[model samples]
Target: MPETFLEVGIAFAGIALASLVAAQLRFPSIPLLIVAGILLGPAVMSAVDELRLMQVFAGFGIVLILFFLGLEFSVGDLLSGARRKVLNGLLDFAINFSLGLAVGLLLLDLSPLGALFVAGIVYISSSGLIARLIFELQRAARVETGLILSILVFEDLVIAGYLAVLSSVSGGTEEAASFLQPALALGIVAATIGTARFISRGAQRLLERIVSDELFVVAIFAALVLVAGLAEMVHISSAIGALLLGLILAETGHVERIEQRLRPVHDIFAGVFFLHFGLTIRLENIQAVLAAAAVAAIISILGKTATGLLAGRIAGLSFPASLTAGLTLIPRGEFSIVLAALAVSAGLSPLIGSFTAVYILILAVAGSLLARESLRIAAWVESLRRPKGNTTSG
Candidate 1:
């Protein structure tokens, strides 16, 4: 099932076009690319079999995306949050993960591990999607918005922990000391930051003295991929490593330039990743698990909504703001897809894989719409909260 170059080209081209359409329609581009993949891949147009390569590309995209996100992480910002973001994130994770597991066991008859996988799917949300929507809704600077994003960041850490645990369990590796992995992971992060800081500072000097912007950008990507590979070799997730790398360089004078230069490549590869994910979804498998998919979607949405609101209230957000934050966090993206792929590869029942894909698609769409509507509600609430002297009612 090797793909010809032409097939790969067509598949990607279709994705790009579809994503443009999705943006114009104000829909999530990832799902649109998924639709593109479904149409262009063997199940329909039969245009490509390059999914293996696409998978590799997707992995890189995830790593890069995390790295960029990490660059945005600042200890100062976290400390300034009125509520502890980590605790807020943890509360949301615990509530939603537990509910997801309970639903899996009660409704799907899954074993503990399978139930854990289901919980992982529901616990992880698409930060990229949510961030974009927040910006579009003009809610990015809201106090509640900060809380929501912080929680999302913490959730990523939780997802990383779970992934490590799941990988160890599936691999039948001896459980090392609980603290060992986190210690090693943290050590790697610290080292990455130190190195990146040095490079970022020196790189600008080097570039001003000799290197061109184009050459500097190329070197940055090369460093990113190289560091990511090293992190994987050390048994740490490359995503975390890359994030540390980015953070180290975040304070560099070149932050804006580096981000801008990297955007195009990130956008292109990310599209391929989402498109490949969508394309690989087997409609037949989904058909077989439609009942389970429907149930999973409902539980995930409701649980996430409930958890988001609870966590928001605790974080001092108003009801409408809390509700919007909750809805914004419901779409499972890269992490959910990665978990599904891992489950299938680890020989979990095929039904789990099928169920995840269908469930994710359903939730992503519904969750996006819910987030949009919640934003509107939040805006309305904010208006209502304004002084009567400052407002005119229709």
Candidate 2:
């Protein structure tokens, strides 16, 4: 047991160190954390042995992260009919999904289920990371930013539905037995959403009564755990449930206070989770599969770019703006890893898990660079569109 603690402690130390370096380097800490995980994990130095429990903990952390993410968006914004914008988001997902599944089948030679898994990977965009990057960009206040945000919101919905479907596919026996998985999953979602609204009101009263910080923390985590457990019982992603839970709680006035207290805890656990993920990678296996992973990564980027651009155009944006918006949303992280983990947990595909991990690592590096350089791209585009000549017509 002491050894377990020691391994966990060392793993955290690695995360801290790597995170600092990544911050200093202006690179996203995700890949660095994974690299550190690889170093400490059994595959490399054999220093960390309690990987199983760490993975479980990390899974919980992912739920918390996604749950908070869901809380950040305004549900009303989604409900607003912005029909063209909404269609753009859906079209982006559909186009990319089709392209990716085709590639998976033709190039990767995966099974039908494997192909669907690949499509999920390709269709799901990382709105969280991309949104943050957009916020950080100098041109974030420009019209492009608004369009990007709109497109990302649409993409997130696709991801949410994808997650629900994936969870059903992975965990639901009834889903496998009948053609009712989509319908059943939809029913579960409607019930969950409706129940969440009712419970959130009461939960706000209870959360406000807690005076002790420790107790507050306990209650918060307990809520997350309870919601996650329920989600798993119903054959859905706990992260999805957690996300919905956060969104529900977001409606309460006290959400800001709760978030303030929970941020530190979320950070600690999330950092560890990312690092632990890195540690799980088998470096040798990744090396052997590097070529395939790289190919998949390229396919992911191209397919997303094409789909996003087409969606932007369809949404009534100009060609240049649409192209820029599409390019901007190409970065991927976190959600892909979660999807891969869910697949592995449900025994849908082990190969997908291994390959997807490698694929995520590649994206984390390349995507961060592109996101950081988005400002440069935005500036160049600004430079290209010369205003109407001030001089008299020739």
Candidate 3:
């Protein structure tokens, strides 16, 4: 860690600067932080030379990200939306994933599993980016806002299942094909989540006795990490373990205390995670993948657009609002990077990493600009549908 101090320090500095820029621009920080990492990291200027240590720390970053994501929604919330939105979520996954798979196989020349990774990368839209857009674009009060957020919620649950089948207990061994043990992995994840919720029956009584904030932090933090470690031991993804831990602990009704005490730690590690991923990208490598990334981005947008439109129609939204929803769902971030890291661990082509980096840059920047103008675009579309006799003179 001492030798790693320079690399670590530079990473945080990049994170700070990126955050400031994103804040000033009133934009989401994901893209800024990622670009900062790429520009400041080894591939470009060799500012942060070593990666082994940062890789270790970034592990904590991902576990925390997945855990906190789980905390934001509860089991009841998932159950409540299962009937109405589950089909829409499935449609979203199918459309984007199919497009990604075809592109990965045909254009990128990836194998089935690697193509699965690509599909995963394209399947889910960026929840953090979209949430910020909803706020900054002043669409928080709009009806479509709730629909968008609901899609995110549904996607979160879907990913839990997707990752379950996609993960292997052996970490990322290349020979260990993940598809070989779907039943076992899903069984383990289901059992672990079930066990956590079952234990929550008495968790409240235990948590209430921890009167000191410091003690509570230590105790709860230990529990979260311990569950994650144990899950990893059994060949389940540690991230899933962290998520299940959050799901179970949420029922304890102490979520507010846990979030308040631990969020800063989560934020710090999250920055490290994104920044480290950025550093691993090779610019020359990106050039080889850039064309593929561009085509993938276009296909991804079209797929998501179709899903959003069909879902909107099923939910009885107006045509313009449907188009707006489709456009806003164009961006992908966070989880896609996480998937690429997992692929690297699984010994997939290193090109996958560069490919993801380029794809994210294209979508995050282009997608935001498109989302901001989507409403205007939708209004124009609606105007096109108007009758000439009904047109008003300006």
Best by lDDT: 3
Question: Lowest summed lDDT over 10 consecutive residues: which window, candidate 3?
Answer: 169-178
Q: Stretches of candidate 3 above 4 Å error?
A: 169-180, 193-196
Question: What tens digits encode model 3's per-residue C-alpha lDDT throughout 243-334?
Answer: 88888888788999999999998988998898889888888888899999999888888887787788888889988788878888888888
Any idea how many clashes model 3 has? 1
After best superposition, candidate 2 residue 96: deviation in angstroms? Answer: 1.3
Q: Which pairs clash in the backbone of model 2?
A: 34-278, 37-279, 67-243
Candidate 2 residue spans exceeding 4 A from truth: 173-182, 194-196, 315-320, 374-394
Q: Each candidate's lDDT (Cα)?
A: 0.74, 0.73, 0.82
Summarize candidate 1's per-residue lDDT along 1-394 as a digit string, tens digits: 3346777788778877997898799877776777787788766777777777777887777777767776675444434663577678778877888877885687667788778887888778888788878888888777678778778877776676576566445544346644466566666555554566566677567546534777877888888999788876766666666776777667566677777888888888777767776667677866878887787778787877787788888877888878787788888777777677666656776667667767777887898788878868667877788888996559
Candidate no. 3 TM-score: 0.94
lDDT of 2: 0.73
- Winner on lDDT between 1 and 2 is 1
Per-candidate Cα RMSD to the true structure, in Å, reads 4.6, 3.4, 2.1
Ordered list by lDDT, greatest first: 3, 1, 2
lDDT of 3: 0.82
lDDT of 2 by residue, 167-259 (tens): 776565663533566566667666655666677779778877888988987888898889888887766678878877887887666678778
In model 1, pairs of residues that clash are: none
